[model samples]
Target: MIYLDHAASTPIVESALNIYIKSLREDFANPSAAHKLGKSSMKKVERARQLILKSLKGSKKDQLIFLSSATEANNLAIKGIKLLPSDRVHYSVGDHPSTSEPVKSLNSQLVEIPLLEGGVIDEAKFLESLDKDSKLVVLSHVNNQSGNHYDILSLGKKVKDKFPNIHIHVDGVQGLTKVETNLSSLIDSYTISGHKIGAPKGVGALFIKDGVEVETQLHGGGHEFGIRSSTVNTPLILSLCEAITAGLEDVITNNKKVKRINSLMREELEAADLGITFPFSLDDTSPYILSFLLPSISSDIVLRHLEMKDIYVASSSACSSKAKGFNAGFDAMKIDQSKHKFVLRTSFSKDTTTEDIETFVKEITNIIKEIKRL
Candidate 1:
């Protein structure tokens, strides 16, 4: 089967999986326990923490809080902030529901920044929406729906320089390993997940900038520096570290390959004369994901057609599929309302191949013809 939903999750690499199994069997002691075995487990966990910090280019002062998934990290980031009725919380309407849900549920006041037609965070709109009374701005390093990404270094700096007291939280699940992140000042927190980058599901981490204090969201054992209080998933943490290392080793080469695959697919689509449209070009967005606007057919139908042929893709974020309303990205991009129900996301992983793209293109071209005839 051809799986093109890497944005939702990826299969764990063999190296990472092997390490996870070994740790689960041998290093099963509780890191918090007061014994030699526990001390050893604690040491391994710290080592993993160091590896993760290095990936984010964070400092020793920065703390990495391991959570179950990026959703939890996002929740912690949003709900952890101390908000008043007068203090406004801000984020792009196009962000993953994980980012938007907590803000919607927990904050009394919210200001949603709109995106440009090309799926970019509208800088002018953002500035207009932001106010001194804002408590935090949640930004995604890579938008989950559309592949268009943000330059975190510049954007984070821009936000902080203008609003010194306001906080910046980044949901970097799609961006962390795909791009270089030099965590600078003013960026208060970042959320990253393992599954999106070849690590196992149910493992993610939050980075709290030095000197930044977000109130603890979960309570119990006082673990994770009191930010979260569950017993650490030691096996998954170690596996996540290994996945990071393995992902980085091939990141440069994989990016080039994915870019080539995108070009190939675009070439085929253009040649086929389908009315399908893509939100952004190769250089403008991520090399890993594409949101294709189908021609006169619902994406759910197309998805099922592809799946029956042993191919897999998504209509939108798997997390937000059941949520009512149109995708914020499409609405922001001003993709025609007629095509709204037909947007399907095709995402790639490091191992995705040219043949896979070719096969998907051929099948989609045929599907378009079949639908047109009907």
Candidate 2:
């Protein structure tokens, strides 16, 4: 079966899988315990943390804490911060639910930055809305639905220049390893997921700048440097580190390969003239994700057709796929509501091949034709 939903999760790398199994089998000691086995486990956990920092190019001064998922990291970034009732938290209009939901649950004035027609963040509008009261802003480096990429580096610089005190947070889940980004200055908090890059689920990391203070929401024995409080998943963390490090091995080449598949998909789909509307130009997107808009076809129907043929894809954010409603990115971009249920999101991984793209395009073409006749 051809699985084109890497945005949801990826297969564990062979090397990382080996380490995971071995760690689960032999290294079952709790890192928090004081015995010799505990000390050894703690040492391994710290080593894994160091590898993660190095892999992401984060500084030693930065605090890297593991969380159950990116959702918790995002909640900690926005909800953990000390906020006044008058303070405002802003999030990009195209943010993932994980990044946007936490802010919504807060008492602070929730501001949503608008998106341009093609799903690009309205930078000018965002700047106009920015003021001294906007204490924090959450922006995703790469959009999950449309595959639209953002120039966070430049935007972060602009935000810092205008409001030196405002905190800038990033959701880098979709961009990690697949896309290269410099996480130096101008970023206060960044969230990344292990599952998105071939590590097992239930392991995510948050990078908070040295001086930034975010209170812990999960009260427990006080783990993750007190940012997230819980027992450490040492084996999974080690496995995540290995996957992240290995995923970076041929990034430049991998990116090119994925982008080629994306381009090929876009080209043939458009050439088919089957009313497939690409929200943005192919070049404007990351190679990892592609959202196809079939205004005249039902995405659910199309999905079933592909499934019967042993191909898998997604209709919306994998995290919120069960919820039936308007998608934020599509809504923000003013896509026709009639076309809402027909949008299909397909994400490719470094392992996706040219033949995979060819088969996908061919099957989609057939599905559209078959559905119309029915």
Candidate 3:
């Protein structure tokens, strides 16, 4: 199949797979144990941590806590901070359910910032929500569904300018290893997923800036610098480190290639007279994700049709795909119900070739025309 669902999860890189296999075979000892085998495993975990820090341009002062997925990291970031006080949490309306749900669960007087039509949070509105009492402000650097990039550096500057004490938490799941994230100086906490950047699933990291007071989510042995308690999965961590370091090394060149292919796909769809809306044109957006509306078609139907042709894509966030009916993300964007029903998301990866784009466009064009005649 010509997979176009990189946003959901990319296939693990061969290098990462090799490291995973080797580590599983050689470093299977428990990191918490004090024996020689354990020490060797612990050493590998520490080395992986160093690689992750280097890849993220973080320092020893920054705390990198490994979790199962971005979802867990987000929950830890939000729920951990919410323990501070009531009504202290703020997040944009477009955040993944993982971030939004934890805040909702706390019933912590949430301040949902409005997003522009292009699906980016209004910085001014976000700033207005901050106060001395505000404990955390969670923002997704690049929205998962719309591919919209947020000017997090500018947002960070504004947040620090207004409320220097307020912590900024960024969910960088979509942006990690794809776009330049130089907000290390501005951001207080950042969340990244291993699978999104071609690492194995069930491995993710949370970056908490020095001196940030976040309560632990898991409670045993005080591992991950006392923030998370699980014994480190040395093999997965090493694989994640390898994938991220290798991915970031060529991210600039790879993103440009994907962007060109994305542009061609958009041009082809438009040239074929398929009704489409490119939301990113209205605001800061990522080049890797493309969401468009197809006239006279349901997203489910289109998805199935494409799959039948050996092409793969998505209708919304992978986390919410199993939910019945329309996605809450599209609803938040104010996508008209009719158009929402027709919306499809096509995500690109560095491995996505020009030939893949051409094939996708041709199949989509023919399918839409056939559907139009029905």
Give the candidates in order of TM-score, highest first. 2, 1, 3
**Candidates 1 and 2: which is better by TM-score?**
2
- Superposed by TM-score, candidate 3 places the C-alpha of residue 145 at a distance from the truth, in angstroms, of 0.2
lDDT for position 349 in model 3: 88
Query: Which pairs of residues collide in candidate 3?
Result: 149-285
Give lDDT tens digits, candidate 2, residues 1-374. Answer: 89999888888888888898999987899989999998898899899887777776778888898888888888888888888989988886567889888888889988988888878888898999989898988899888888888888899999999898889999989888878867767889889888888888889999888799998889889888866788888889888889889988888889898888888888888898788888776777888999888848778888889999899999888877876657666888778767778889899988788888889889989989877888
Per-residue lDDT tens digits for candidate 3, residues 1-374, read 89999999999999999999999999888998999999989888888887787777778777888889999998898878745446577876677888888878875667887776768677677778788778678888888988988878888898888889887899999998998876458798899899998899999999888788889889999898888998889999999999888888988898788888888888887887787666556236688998888775788889999999989999878887876556667667767555666778999888788899889988988888888898
Candidate ordering by lDDT (highest first): 2, 1, 3
Score candidate 3 by TM-score against the native: 0.96
Write out the backbone clash pairs for model 2. none
Candidate 2 residue runs with Cα over 4 Å from true position: none
Predicted candidate 2, C-alpha RMSD? 1.2
The residue ranges of model 1 lying beyond 4 angstroms of the native Cα positions read 323-325
